[model samples]
Structures are given as structure tokens and as C-alpha cells.
Target: MGHKLRLLWAAYRKIVYVYLLLVLLPACALLYVYFHKASAELERQVAESMLRAVEQVRINVDYRLSIVLEVSDSLILNELLYDNLAEPASGYRFDQVMEQRNLASLIKSLKGHDILGIKLYVPDDKLYAREHVHFFGLSEARAQPWYGDVMARSGAAYWVSTRPQLYGAAGEVQALSLARLIRDPQRFERVIGIMEILVPETNYAPILSGAEFADDAEAMYILDRAGRIVSHSGASRIGERLLPQPQFAEMTSGRSGILRFAHRGEPYLAIYDTLQQNGWKTVSFVPARAISRPDWATSFASPLVLILSFLLLFILAAFLVFAYVTDGMVARLRQITSRLRLRGAETVGERIANRRGVILRLEQSVAHMLTTHEQLVADHYETRMKEREAQLRALQAQINPHFLYNALDTINWMALTRGASDISRMLNTLAQYFRLTLSKGRDLVTVEDELNLARAYLDIQQHRFDNFTFELELDPAVRECRIPKLTVQPLVENAVLHGIQRKEGHTGRLLVHAYASGAGYAIRVRDDGAGMPAEQAERLTSGLQGAPGPAPAGYGLYNVMERLRIYTHGRCRMQLDSAPDVGTTVTIFVDRLPER
Candidate 1:
């Protein structure tokens, strides 16, 4: 008995030391993984919060700028302004004064809560008026860049800087101006004068400042076409150029959305949005530290405390096992082993048979754990796929063909009344094109159906252009190949209008062909007009494929690419090739539809 007790003590001491060493390493490794995961989770949460806050700021800024543009459009297209510009300068001079007074009253009415000041520029007299008073001489007005740009564009509205001459003496020097040419209705060919509006920075400050986030977050700003700050929460930074360095300049050129940059020695997360209509950019910034900071002690301390408690329980359990099961079982087991060795090998076999029941129970427990792990993995993957599908559907829902159709109809009617038959016919064709576009009930349509729609569009365009010609060559085998609806029409239209119309005296040729390639079908549209430069073509493709929302090129191509990606599981192919003055070709390839 004394020898057995001494042997048990020595064995127990060695087992306890080994167990502690084994448990300690795992416990430390677990601690490291726990903290590392917690830090990563913290960073993701911060980035998401910052993105949401900056997005809200972007919405507010867009709303404000939209209001400004709307007001500017209303003033430029005002009947009184148009009537005043129409009449000859000699007999209609007094009439112009009365009209100007009425316009001033209208401006005051429209200015109820938003506008800071209004101005009108007459190129002939070099005369300019703001809030009912003539301010600049003809020579002085002509010298201004805003006047030159308004003349250069002929009639389209443009945004400009509000200097002291046009804006009120008390008004802010750095204000936004909207200018458009006032054309005569009779001829519809002459520019009579320019109309301008000076919008105060204070009106936009609220938009820049109202961006809300956690206390640690910062607001965003907008850079004008020249890269000068137009709107910002920080007043001092307004009008200063932010992208003076080559790196920032490169970053700003045609790039949009969330980016990281260091400013004034602090790292910041910036969300940038470029306004396609105005060539202006809005950027919001939050401190990187603010976005990535984690309360490590708070987030990880609870888990660590639980782990420590678990270790305590494990230690107590080990001690209990040592006192109860180990002390008794190991002693008995050793005695049995010694007896078997001294006597015969048959006793050893009998002892091993008795332990089979315990080993069987352990096997069942391990199998159950494996089954649970596999189920968890499958559930995670299913959840992720569903989330991605939902996002794609949401994006598809936002493409509104109705608004585009309405805008086209308006342009068509305006052109018809003005006797610009070519422009009117083009607008009508565009309207008909989109009408069919909205009619396709399904998001996906056959390649044959899409090509027929493109042909209908081209027929109308051909009537409008008179000299432009096009041909289609489709492989009968691939005609029924599935593709997104209205995909090819816009590219064809771009080729006709931008490529063909701008070229010198020569017949324009547009060729569209489709054929089978491997397991997919390839559709190509090539034009023999003034082809785009390589850089411009790159920009067009990048914008179509990469932008988050509807790109300005046309919602059709963007929608098509997105749908193809979803349907083909990223197997669809899109390519663009073009050379200046040669031509442009756009190709799309997708999986062939299964036979009916």
C-alpha cells in the first residue's frame, strides 16, 4: 500500500504539469484570436457608420444644388426674359425696362427663401443688371469668362464664379453663378443676351454642414470644375484648390466614391461623388482614426473574463478529477497491469474489453460535432448569397425609363415647333426607342428581340439623318441567345449622333453583327464615322461597368451589364475597341440560351 501511494503521487504531479502546459498555450492563442477579430469588427463598424453619415451629406448637397439649378432654369426660360431679348434694341428699349422690372418682381417671388441675387447680361450693349440695376459696361462684361462661355455654348446653361461686379457689393465674392444664352424665338438661331444668377454660399453651407455622424466624424465638401472648393463645412477652405498635387489630381480625374487620403497630417476616409451634368465633384471626409478606433477594453474584456472563468472552472475540474477518478482509477489500472505482466497476457485482453463501452460513447460525440459544423458552414454561405441577390434587385428597380422618355418628348415638341425637323425627328426616335424599352416586362430578353428593337431605333434615326446608313448581320444560330433588354440601342445611337453627325462630308456606316463563339454568343456594333479617342473610350466603358448608380451614357448598357453578371454568374464578356477618326466597336458575349 505504501509503494502504491508513492507511485500515485509521482504520476499525479507529472500529469498536472503536462496538462497545465497544454492548456496554457491554447488559452493564449485563443486570447490573441479573440482580440484580433474584435479589432477587425470594430474597424468595419466604424467604416460603415462613416459611409452612412457621408451618404446623408451627399444627398443633402444634391438636393440643394438641384434647387439652385431648377431656379436657374426657371429664370433663364422665363417668357418675360425671352420677350425682352427678342425685340430690337431701339424701339423695344423701354419695353425691355418694363420687362426687366417684371422679371425682378418674379425673381423676388422665386427668391422667397433661396436665391441671394439675380443678374442679366446683354452682349450687344455690354450691359449687365443685378436686382434691377445696370452694373457693367459692354466692354467690361465681354471681358468676363462667364460671358465668353455663355456665348461659346450658344444656349446651354453653365455654372460660373460670382465676382464683385455681378453679385451685390455686400454679397459673398465666392458665389455660384448660372448663365445661359437668351435666344430669339423667331429665328431660333441668334443669341440675344445672357442670363445669370448669383447664388450665395450661405445657402449651400447648411448642406455641407448638416452631415451628421458620431461626434468623432467630419463633414464633406465639393470641388468646382477647376478643383477649387465650392462648398465646405470649413469656411476658410472654400475657394482653395484641394487637388493641387499630381497624386490628388490623378485621383480626382474621373474617379468617384469612397477613397482614403491624408490631409494636414491626419488620415481621412473620403466619399466622392461626381456630378455628370455639371462636371462638379462632392467629397466628404472623416478622420481615419475616428472611423477605425476601437474600444478594445470594452469590446474584448467580457469575452476574456468568460475565458478566464472557464479556465478557473477547468482548473477546479482537473483538481476534482485528480482527487476522485484519477487517484482511484490510475491506481487500480496500474495494479491490474502489473498483475497481467507477472501472470499472463490473457488477463490484459479481458481488461481492454471492459473499456470498449467508454470508447464507443466518445466516438458518437465526435460524429455529432462534425455534423453541426457542416450545417453551420452551409447556412453562412446561403445567407451571403441571398444578401448579394437582394442588392442586385434593388439596383435594377432604380432604372426609371419614364423620366427619360418624358424629357425626350419635351425636347421633341420644342424642336418641332421651332422647325428644326432633324432635331425633332431625332427626339421622336429616342422617345419611341425608350417606349419599347419600358414595354419589355422581363429584365432579360433574347438577342433577337434586342436586335429588332435596335433596328426599329435605327430606322427612325436613318429618317432623321437622311445620309447615315447602317446594316445588321446576325447568325441565325445565335439569334435566340439571351441578353438584357435594350442593351444595344444606346451604343448605336451614340455612334450615329456623336460619331457620324460630327464628321465631314461623307456617308456614315454602322455595322452590327452577332455570331456564336464557344458556349456563348458574341454581338458586335461597329461604326465608320469619327471614332472616339482611346482615353474617352476607356472612360465610357469604365463608367458603364463600374459606377454604382445609372451612368449618364444610358441606363440600358449599365442595366444590361449588371443583369448579365447576375444571370451568367460573372461569365459574360463585354469589350470596347476604338480609334480616333477611324471608328468604334462594342462587343458583348453571353451564354447561349438552352434549347426550348
Candidate 2:
């Protein structure tokens, strides 16, 4: 009996040793995976936090600039400024002097606001006046780009470049200037000068230089428009350009939202927004390191400490269990452990092969389920999308038909009012145009049909105007291409109604061109009429969602964009490029439809 007990004791030791090693291997593997995953999760959280910080900066800067620009608008519309300018002989031959005086008074009214100084530039007289005229007196304003641009735009507000200049009582040299043309409200003619506001460095510097994430993290300044580093909180390289240039230009052009950049050897995430009021782009950059520091430290320390504690507790429990078990049972367990080791080696390969087979079958089953589910989802979505499209079409139909009917009725009334046979003929043509626009039951029509409809609309408009010429250039290849019905006509109507109708001295030229683009067809309607500003074009493109309200008197650009989005499932695109005197181009891109 003593010999058997001794044999069991030896057997038990072997069993415990093998069992502990087997459990330890898997525990170690699990620990590795847990830590790796934790690190990855920490990185993602950090990146997101950095993004949020930058966005906050963008919001704050844009908000401040918008307020300043609103103030500038009020100054332009102010009766006092107008009254002062109207009295031309009050020792102010140039309106710039009066603007500077009035701007100074306006700045004082906003007592605690961050306005550093006010200045004015008169291009025709080549004169400029700031608050501290003793230092920068009557400079050649024509040579400055700000003055040139203001003259070129006639009456538009713009944020000028940042350059060092002296102003105010202290005569401190600093980055300064915001300029806008002063124009007569009645005729919209330029009234002698451009108003310039000097922005205080303190107002902008604090935005660039605040505690962002932690002690180690810093914020940097880049050109609000181009993302070029104008200043950095750290490092001497302020003017040097950042690499992988952040999409600052695109943001300024109003294309995208978040941007990332590496400035001063530190990675930064940037959030940017365009200021509609002043045309200035504001961006906030925050270091990526700041966001991840807490998470990274916690991820490393907590996991290692948890795994060690768990290992110690598990080892103690395992030893106690082995101690309590009988010696004879321990011998059996040793044999079992030896068999398990052999089985485990084989099981690894077997499990891998079996897992592959199981995974293959699982994947096939999942694929079949997904296919059925996707088809069902697609059908449901397609049905809903179609219903929405139909509702939009119904709404659009109500508007277009009403507009055409009113236009025709007006033409008929005009013919009777004039008692002219020519007017009667014009009314007949106009009626036919309206009839074509109200096509029997078709939403998608041939490009040829659209062109014919547009020509008819133009014919009526030309007759009404007595002096409008239109040219049509159609590519024969695109004649069979299908397009949303009434697309071309509305664009042409916009041109005639908004562009040419209001201008008195010049004859308007309307050009319609159709051409082939990559994998699609493009149709452009162009007009040499009073073109819209960039801001107006941006609003028209972006403001398509929600309720359709009263449109501007002449152009229904938004309506056209909405109709295109609905019909083409966003495949079709419309682009409008315009300048005040350079005229406007409205281009439409549509996929070439398969032959019916």
C-alpha cells in the first residue's frame, strides 16, 4: 500500500506540470490578442477626438468672421455713411475719406469687439486712408491687389491677404485687412471706394494658440483658404508649406469638410468651413498625439496588470485543485495529459482543416441568405425611392404646368392687347411650347425633344424681348441620348428671364451646346448676360433638399438641380460657373441611355 501511494504521488506531479503548461500557452495567446485589439481601439478613439477638436475650432472661427462681415454689411447699408458720401464737397473728393471716418465710428460703437483698425482705398483717385493716416497716408491704392479686386468686382465683400502693416494709435505692424466695395443700392454702381477693416492679431492668435488636448499637444495656423502654414504655435518654420497639402483649397471652394495635415513634424487633424458672409475659410488643427495619450497609456497599463493578476489567481486555483485530487487519480490524469498533448498537436491541423470546411459551408449559407436579404432590401429600397421620385415628380408637374399655362395666358392677353396678327402668331407658338412641355405621359424624353422644347420657349421669349439672339450647337451623336424632360428649357428660361431681361444697353447671346464626355453626354446652356456671384451659384446647388418655396423672380436653377437628382439617381450632375461680367455656363452631365 505504501509503494502504491508513493507511485501516485510521482504521477500527480507530472500531470500538474503538463496541465499547467497547456493552459499557460493559450492564456498567453489570448493576452496578446487582447492587448493588440486594445491598442487599435485606442488609436481609432484618438483620431476621432482629434477630428472633433479641429471641427470645434472651425466653427468658432467661422462664427466670429460671420459676425464681422454682418457688421460690414450694416455699414454699407447705413444711412449715415450714405449721407456722408452724398455730400461730395465736404472736403472729401474721394468717398474713401468719409468711409474711413464712418468705419472708425462704427468700430467704436462695438466697443469691446476685436476690431483693430479701419481703412479705405479709392482706386480712381489712387488714395488710401487708415485710422493712423500719419503713418500710411494716401498710398497708391491702385497698386494693391485688394483695391484692384474690389474695382473688378464692383461691389462684393472679400477677405484680403495677411501681410504686416502698421495701424491704430500704437502703429504696430501686423497682419491686417478685410475689404468690400461700396455701391449705390439704386443702380448697383460702384460708389468711389472700398471699405477695409483691420483685424487684430490677438483676435486670431488666441484661436491658433490655446490649450487643445494636453501639455504636449499644440495647435498650428495655416492659410484659411489654402492650408499653407501662415504660423505655428511651435517651431520657427511659419511660412514653409506643409506636405501632402491639406485639402484647404477644396474646402475654401466649398467642396469638403474635414482635412488632415502634418505641420511642424507633428501630425494634425484639421476641420474647416467656409464663411459665406466674408468668403474667408477657417480651419482648426489639433495634434493627433494629444487625443491618444490617455487611451494609449490606459490600454497598455491596464491590460498587462489584469493579465498578470489573472495569471497569479488562476495558477493558485489550479495548484489547489491538483493538491486536493487523489494520487491514483493523478496517475490517470498524467496519461490523459500525455494523450491530450498528442491529440492537441493533431487537433490543431484537424481543427484548421475542419474549420476551413465548416467556414466554407457557413460562407455559402451566409452568401445565399445575404443574396436573398439584399434582393429583398433592394426591392424595398427601390420601391420607396420610386415612390419618393413620383411624389417629387407630382410636385414638379404641378409647378411646371402652372407656369406654362400662365406664360401662354399672358401671351394670349398681350396679343389681344396689341391687336397685332404677329402677336397672335407668337402666342400660337408659345402655346405649342407649353403643350410639348406637358408631354402626354413621359418623364424621360430624347435630347432632341428637349432641344425642340427649349427652342420653342426661346422663340416666345425672343418675341417678347424684341432683341435676344440664341445659337444652338448639337452633336449628332447625342441626339438619341435620353434626358430628363424640360431640363434644357428651364435653363434657357433662367437665362432669358434673369440674364437678359433686366439689361438695357447690350444684346444678350445665348449658346446651347451638346457634346460627348467620358461614358456620358454633356449639354451646356451659356449666356452673355448679367452673371451671378459664386456664392449664389453655391447656394443654388446645395439648397435642393426640403420644401420648395417661392423661387427668385427669374432663375429656377435649384428646381433644375432637384429634378436632375430625382431622375438620374444622382448620376447626372449640373455645374454653374459665373462671374458678374464674364457671363454664366450651366453644364449638365447625363449617362447615355441604352437604346429602347
Candidate 3:
């Protein structure tokens, strides 16, 4: 057992070495080069896509902000509010009411589904809402920081950033506000009040969280100059400050590009663009995994899995190509080895050294050696074919057909001269037998001639032995069909010699029948005599003997089968049905019309 295991291990090691050298090493090197090149190209594409996505989001934010500016412009341009609000202490009570109505109407016209509310704080210390104006002290308005900020940036818009607009003690909502210092249209310089639009953070969520970038984007937000998130995809981060802000020095540096950073141990790519309208930055955060992902197949597979799959396919394809070539060489080598043995020679090494040795030197060299061995085997095969043909001609020369015909004719004349009826009939049958068997040396003959040959042969056999009787039932439709000569005669001969002659104490009967069955013709020879056992019957059809080496008998049957197979190219089939003490029936079926 140990010796066998060691031999197995040695063979396994040899095969593994060859496999690694021929298949695995080359495949791995190619795969490595391809994977790196593909990964680099894929990363560039992903970065470009992310940049485009971020640019698109920035464009959308700018467009929405322009709409807000348009609304602010519409308010300042209205003559009714400008006339009444610019003169703070005019005290025209009816005009103030009319101006309040006009301001309410303007806010109603500009407000959309995404708008929360609008506020107009007049320098008169009065806040004009939808219905009326609420008076407040001028000192209170001047003390507010946002009020002072709006005053400082007169004639321009300012972002108050994101903050929670508290409605009640228990209710609060995230809102993004834009405040503008409303000025008198006549002076174009005198500030009247601060006009602010408070909008829900949800209004800009669609622009920030564009569906096209959903696969990779983690977040999108508009950041104020102070690095505070004014508008974010999720309302929860609307008022949050970006901690550890990246490229803070470059944020207002008037440059726009992508930035790579890690957050909470997770890597991310930040694509940002500065908005000239508000001095704010629009940023889109994309996860590193998403940026590194290639396509559907590679994206779904882990990096390890993708590398392993590439290796597996590479090795499998290389091995398949190698094995296919190796199998062809191995088959040719086996054929050569078989031929050498038949010629009473061993392998190439044995022939050269007069001793046994392994035919293959190394796995890598085996294919080349086999190819050269095949060339030698081809020459040997040609010589053997010529010798076999010569042997066949010599065997044919020993059977002189003309001399045998003449002898049969002489015997017939003698039997007739002696007035011996039985002898004359038997001699005539023998002459017909020899004539049909020869058939002018033609291998194929009409079915009628074949049947006649069987009939004559059987007649001679029955005449020579009176223990058996025979009957012939042939279909006329198939009698003209061509068949191999002496096809039916051999079966009849077997029935007489092996079947009937073996029976005892009773007379035997032989039946020879030929008929059309479906698209083919069946020729059957049956004998009611001593039948063979199941094993012998099986061996008769299968051509397998109980032991190795040559069969002791049954050469005629096997030869007939081989000839039929070659003549029909395997289209014809033969079957044997028999049981002990019953009878034996041999049926030959030819499936196609005979050629010529």
C-alpha cells in the first residue's frame, strides 16, 4: 500500500509540475497584466462619470437659486410696494393698506409647493406679513445679527444658511433661507428693508440627490462660505457643519475639482464646484467602493472573487487546449504501440536497446516523441497492409475453381452413366453448389442466386445425411435484390453441422426464409435440433469467448458478420435466438436497398 501511494505521489508531483509550467504560470502573468490595465481604465471612467454627475447637480442648484433671485427681483420692481415702503414715515394710512394688499398678492403669486413662507422687514420697524404689518422697535431690528448682515450686503443676496424654523414648543422644521436687502427703485441705492424667502430643505433634495448618481453618491449638499450645509439631500443635515472639512483653504480659492478623503474609516471621493452667485460650494460625495466598481459583473463580485475567476478561466482554457493536443498525440502513440506489438516487437526503446524502458521521457517531451513515433508507425502500417494483401492472394490461389468444376462435371457424367439416380442428383447439386459459390469471383450477387446457393448446399448436405429435412420460403419481391454471395449458405451450413448433427434419437428440420420487413429485408435460418446454452448463444452474437486469445471455432459466423458490417458500413444487423433443447434461429436484417 505504501509503495503504491508513493508511486501515486510521484506521478501527481510530475503532473503538477508540468501543469504549473505550461498552464498556470503563463495564465497568471497574462491575467495580472490584463487586470491591472482594465482596473485603471475602469477607474478613469468612473471618475469621469462622477465628475459629470456632480457638474449636473451644480447646474440644477444654480438654476433653482436663479429662480429664487427672480422672485426677489420681482418684489423690488413692483411699484405699489416700492412707493409705499420706501417712504417709511409718510403716514398715508389708505396707501399703506393698499401696499400691504399688493405685497401679500406678490408673495402669493411667487410662492410654490416647495416654498415655506416669505417675510418683508421694513426699516419703519414693521414686519409686513400676508394680512398686516406688526410694528417693532427700530432698536430691536438694528440689534439682530442677520438684520445687520443684510444691511451690510445691501443690493446683493445673502444666504442666512440652514436653521430650524421653530413653529411651536414641540414642532420644528429644517429650512434654508435667502435674504436680500430690498432697495428703492428710484434711488437705486437707498435700502428699504430685508426681503427673505424661507424654503423647506426638501425643495432642493431632488437636485442634490439626482437619481442618475444614486448608485455611487453618498450625499450632496450646498455649503456656505462658513462650511455649513445650507441645503442637503437629507433634511437632518441641513444645519450641520462639515467637521474636518477637506481643502478648506481651496474652497474659496475659486477652483473646482474632485477631492479624495476618508471619513469614519471609509474612503470617499468628493466632487465640488463653487457657485459664483452666492460664494457657496456644491459638493457630491461618492463612496470609494462605488468609484472603484467596474461594471455589473465585476461590481457584484468581490476583488478576490474576480481575481480567482479570472485565474480559473485562464487555467481551464489553457489546459483544455493543451489536453486536446495531448489527447491526439496519445491516441496516435497508442496506435503505434499496438502495431509494434502485433509485429512481434516491443516499444521504440525496447527495439533499440533490446530491453524494456519507459517510452515517455518527460511530460513536456511526450507530444514531440509521439509525433515522431507515428511517422515510423505509418511506414510499418503500409508494409503490413501489402503483406496482408499478398497473403490473401496466396490463399485464394490454392483454391483452383476450374479444376473443381471439371471434377464435379466428371462425377456427374459417371453417376448418369451408372444409372444411379441418387448419386446423379447429389452430384448435380454439388456442381450447382460450386458454381454459386464461385459466382464468377464476384463478391455480390442477386438474392435469387444467393438463395439458390443455399438451396444447393443444403440439398447436398441432406443427400449426404438422411437425418434432416429442409424447407425454403422466400419472398419474390426481395429475390431480385442484390446481396453478398454465400450469405445464406453459411447459416444453413451451420444449422446442418452444429445444430442438426448434434441432435439424437430424432430427425431434425431446417427452415430457410427470406422476406421484406418494413424498409428492410430479413433472412432467417432456423433449425429444430440441439440448441445451445444461453452463454454460448450470447457468445455467438457478441463474439466474446470464455477466455482470452483466439476463438476455437465460430470463425465462419464471425467472418460473415464482419463482411456484412463492412459491406453495409454497419447498416446491416444480425441476431441469434436460441434456447437449450428448443431450436436456434439466425436472422440477418439489411436496412437499405442493395447498391448494384
Candidate 4:
């Protein structure tokens, strides 16, 4: 028996090792390949999303400046200002004191949200400075930095905010100024002066808002042609030249698109585009790891770990079963050979040849020892009885409760202290989910309790999903309102399974919003998933009671509707609004509930 056991153990080891090689290596390789693909795809989506946001910022900036451009276009149409600055205004022909009033009126006509100050540089400086209007000499225009660019523009307009002296209100007053070269066509198109219109920094600064990607750490900026920060969420950064960045060369290369590079030894993604109106770059800078790790990578890790863990358990189980079966067969061979030796049978067939396989020799020896049919039948019956007894014990073990809840509590504690807080949190949430679900078998539950159950379910799902996120909003007044116990959970499940999971590429959002309406309340479950058509959405809201067979599509929704109808005495109705590729929104409008 001992020798036979050694043979079985050797074969068991071979099979186990071979099976592991077959399963583990391939699974790991496939996981690596798929993970690479998913990471690349996720990074692309993040880049595209960031690019669109930055592009929107650019459009906003362009739109604001275009409004100012319109004011410039309207100001250029004023012939009186051009005539006033054409040359020294006739002191006898026009009121010298009223020339300031005349210029101020021109500034007022051109004034809107776009203009704060208008400085006209005249060669013959006769007029003094006013609140909105200022007259300077050709030398004054030469002193300004953007003056050359405005002159180089020839007949076109130019916008400059690169330096402080460019502003009429010293350097302290920061504003985007539009400069246009005023020319006299009647005087052979000779240069008259430079027209400068000032727009306060506060105007477009708020349009940058607080928009960011991934988190607040990710920054969005409107940069000038000189690489200086024009408009930023942080006001202090305005006019400051952005510190030398590695990608600054690539970004300034004038090809507006996405690029990736490392900053400070860490990877970063830069999505930049040039604004057409101002020729400024809108850069949305984000950390590369921030865009990838928290999303799908987390989703992959947990599932991969669970699968590998199960594979290990399976390998162990395989070896255990192999050992168990081999022990029984080898023991039977020993019993047969011992009995034959006592009965004087010819040494239980030929002496086991080492040349033949161990299994083959054992088989032949057992055949000779069991020559009598009666002894073999007796051994078989005994072996069957042993197996039956073992199965009965295993059955009892499986059915026994063994204080499952207490075991879970022990596991929760073990996970918590060992720095597996995530596991502990998931286990606690799961336990709470079950407790809330049962609710002591109560049918009606407060809106708050129902939302808690939904939240618990979503929290657990969040672990498995990397690209998925959800929000739960409950108005304080609606928390006490009672609704069906399991209503919200099923809806959330439907949204996650049908909506978020089915969504292709990019993050999925599930929102459960509950609030008081008029005399009653409303519950909204929305998902940015692969939304269905209006007809399909309408069909989904219909209860399945009259259907011929099981309709898997609408079953969960139908149950919720029926439960709500019965619980609220027909005071509630569910409505669905959905559009293809846009999203789905399911609203439960609850009428006034009767007092118990």
C-alpha cells in the first residue's frame, strides 16, 4: 500500500504542475494583454474629454473677445473721432473744450461690457485726458509695446495684454486691450494714431470658472502668444509667464492637438489648442496616472485577484481529491494481497516487475489476489459504505449554519486591523445591505431607508466597476416619506446592469435623486448609459402583468411599478424619458400619500 501510494502521489504532482502551467501562464498573459489595451483606451478617452473641455474654454474666450471685437468694429465706423484725430482740430471751427466731450461721446457710443478705457494716440496732442478717452502723441504710441504689432497689422486690429505699460491706467490696471491703426484715406492713407480699447481682466476671468479635469490638481489655462498666463482659475497667475515646461516647445509649435510628456519625472497629458480670436493657447494639463489608475485599473485588479485566488483553491481541491481516491484504491489492493498471502496463493501473482508501470503491476497483482468473486464483492460493498459515510458527513457540514454572521464579523475585524480597510468596508456595507433589505420583513420603508439600501448596493458595485460612479441625493424633507422597501435597489440594479455596464468607452454615471414636489415627492434614477429610443423607454415603464411570458427587459421595472402602486394606493406612477446615445432618466412621481 505504501509503495502504491508513492506511485499515485508522483502522478498527482505531475498532473497538478501541468494543469497549473496550462492555466496560470495563459491566464496571466491574457490578463496582461487585456490590461494594456484597456489602459490605452482609457487614456485616449481621458485625453479626448480633456481636449473637448479645453476647446470649450477656448470658444468661451473667443466669444467674449469677439463681442469686444464687435465694439471695435462699431467704434471704427465713427467718422467724427477719425476727423478729430486727422490733424490739429480747428480751434475756431470746433469747440476746443467740447472736443473732450465729443471724444467722450464717441467712447460712450462704443462702450458696452467690452470697453473700460479708450486711449487714442494722436500726433498733434491738443486734447487732454478724460475718464474714458485719452489723447497721446505718435511718440506715446511708439513707447507702447503692442503699438508695432498694431502697425504691423496694417489695416487690421490687434489685441495685447502682455505688459503693464500697454494699459493707459499704468501697469497696475490689467485689461485686454484691442489696438487698431487709425489711418486717413483722404491724406493718401497716412498714419493718424493708434486706437486702444481696454477690456477689464475681470470680464473673461470668470468664464474660465473652476473647470478642471480629474481633480482640482489638474489645471486649465488660457495662455497668451508670449506663453504668459492670460486667464486662469487662479487670478494671481494672470500675466505671469508659465514656468519653463518641457512640452512648451511642442505646444508652441502651433500644431494644436494632444501630446504626452513627463514633468518632474512623472507623466503628464497636455491637450492644447490655439484660440482663433486671440491666437492664445488653451492648455488642459493633467497627470497621466490620475487619468488611468482610479478608473478601469481598479476594476481589473479586484477581479483578477479573485480569479487567481479561485484558481489556487481549485488546484488545492484537485490535489486533495486525487489523494483521497488514490488512498482508497491502494488500501483495497493491500487488503486483497494480505488475504491471498494468508490463503497460500502463489505470492499474489508474479513479483511486481519494476520494468512495468507501477499502476500496471498493481492492477495485475490485485487481479490475481481477487481471483475469488465472493471476496471482491465483499471488499466493494465495504468501500461503498465508507464513501457513503464520508458523503453524509460532508452533507452535514455543508448544511450546518456554523454561525455565519459571527464568522463574517470575525472576518470584518481581521480585515480592518490588517490594513484591508477596503475589504472591511465592503463586508460591512454588504452586511448592512442585507440588514436593510430584510428590514424585519417590513413592506413599507422610509425614503431614507430605501435610499440607504440603494446606496449600499451601489457601494458594492463601485468596487467591481472602474469606469462607473454614482450619486445619491435625498432632500431632507423627503427622507421621512415612506415608499416600497425594495423599490430603489432594483432600479439601481437595472441602471447599473443595463445602463452603466452597457455604456461603451468613458466613465458611467448613475444618479438617484429624491426630493419633495408640490404636495408629494419625486424619485429620479438617471444613467449616462446606452439610452434606448423613446418608444422603447415608454414600453419599459409599462408593467409586465399582462405579458404572455416573462419579459426580462421590463421585469424589474414592472415589479417596482406594481409595488409602488399597491403601497401608495395608486398614488405613484413611473415615467421614463430616454434618447438614443444621450441618456435615460426614470422618474417616479408620487402623489399625496394618505396618513396611517
**Top model number, TM-score:** 4
Q: Per-candidate TM vs. native? A: 0.47, 0.45, 0.46, 0.50
lDDT of 1: 0.65
User: Candidate 2, clashing residue pairs?
Assistant: none
Prediction RMSDs, each to the true structure: 16.0, 17.8, 44.3, 31.5
Q: Rank the candidates by lDDT, best first.
A: 4, 3, 1, 2
Comparing 1 and 2 by TM-score, which wins?
1
Q: Which candidate, 1 or 3, has the higher TM-score?
A: 1
For each candidate in the order shown, give its overall lDDT on alpha carbons: 0.65, 0.62, 0.67, 0.71
Question: In model 1, what are the clashing residue pairs, if there are any?
Answer: 126-138, 220-284
Model 4, 113-173: lDDT tens digits are: 6677777776654645323236676776786777778888985878787344354434565
Worst 10 residues of 4 by lDDT: 354-363
Return the TM-score for candidate 3, rounded to 2 decimals.
0.46
Q: Tens digit of lDDT per residue, candidate 2, span 1-596?
A: 78965775686767657756876667678767876675455545444443444444544555556556656655665556555443343445456555555645765674347566656543333233333442132255656667666677666667765566666555664554567776644345646555777665456657766625444544545453545454345435444444444445445655335555666777755555444435444444556565455555554555556666667877677656665565367776888789888778665455422111112322333454556456556655655565556555554454345446677788788878888778788878877876777675478888877888888888888877777899888888888888778788878877887777655555789999988888888999999888878887666655544444345722366667666777777777777787787678889887645354
Model 3, runs deviating above 4 Å: 1-5, 8-33, 90-95, 125-144, 166-172, 184-190, 212-218, 251-255, 293-596
Task: Write one digit per residue (lDDT tens) for candidate 1, span 1-596.
Answer: 78976876686777768766887678778778866775555555455444444444544555565666667665654566665556655445566567666656776766635566666555454222332353332344576777777778877778884333334455345567677777776577876666666777667767766764435533667777777788766767777776546635654665465666677887766667666447677676567665434354555566667667767988788767666765498876788788888998875466422211122322333454455456546654554454455455445444445446667888888998999998886776667666666553465667777787798798887876678888988899887777766578777876787678767764589998988888878889888878767877777677666763333443555666766677677778678788978887888877555443
> How displaced is residue 340 in candidate 4, in Å?
35
- Minimal lDDT window, size 10, model 3: 355-364
Given candidate 4, what's the lDDT at residue 584? 82
Please identify which of the two predictions, 1 or 4, would achieve the higher TM-score against the true structure.
Answer: 4
